[model samples]
Target: MFFQAGASMVENQNADAILLAGTDLGLAFDGHDPGYRVIDALALHVAALTDLATSGRG
Candidate 1:
């Protein structure tokens, strides 16, 4: 997963944008996964990149 994330980040020209995937488990399961947090962080990075691009900073 980390490798994939790195690849994606590299492909984006090392931009600060990221993508995340979220899932919901059954009632018997209720916990957060580290992967999810990683994804969230990536997403934030991506968003910042987008903002920069739109602002002509990229």
Candidate 2:
């Protein structure tokens, strides 16, 4: 279902990827591919934090 919707949006808008806001929505894409690119905003934020932490850059 998610894939279909995303596909439609991609086709209609020529989008390269899908943006998913909200912190808890990662569960939907976990261990599964939606047949297109779907980026979880929360995950990207966390990953940026993790990288900063590891790099010792405040």
Candidate 3:
């Protein structure tokens, strides 16, 4: 329901993407396209942490 409404707003407002910051959002958005770009904050955070952990470790 929210994704559908959000997608509509995205199209109407010409927005570029949606950011999924809720933990349970995965249940709704995983493997779902939602007709727009979806940014998973947890994935980005994990990736950044991985990079930081490996950066200065030789």
Best by lDDT: 2
**For all candidates, what are the clash counts?**
7, 0, 0
- Pairing residues by index, what is the TM-score of model 1? 0.32
Model 1 Cα lDDT, one tens digit per residue, 1-58: 5446545665666645433443321111234332222345444567899999899868
Residues 1-58 of candidate 2: C-alpha lDDT, one tens digit per residue:
7768789989999989988886756777788887778999988999999999999895
Q: What TM-score fits each model?
A: 0.32, 0.74, 0.77
> What root-mean-square deviation over C-alphas does model 3 reach?
2.2
Candidate 3, lDDT over the whole model: 0.81
Q: What is the Å distance of residue 25 in model 1 from its true position? A: 15
Winner of 1 and 2 under TM-score: 2
Model 1 regions more than 4 Å off: 1-39
Error of 1 at 28 (Å): 17
Rank by lDDT (best first): 2, 3, 1
lDDT at 44, model 3: 87
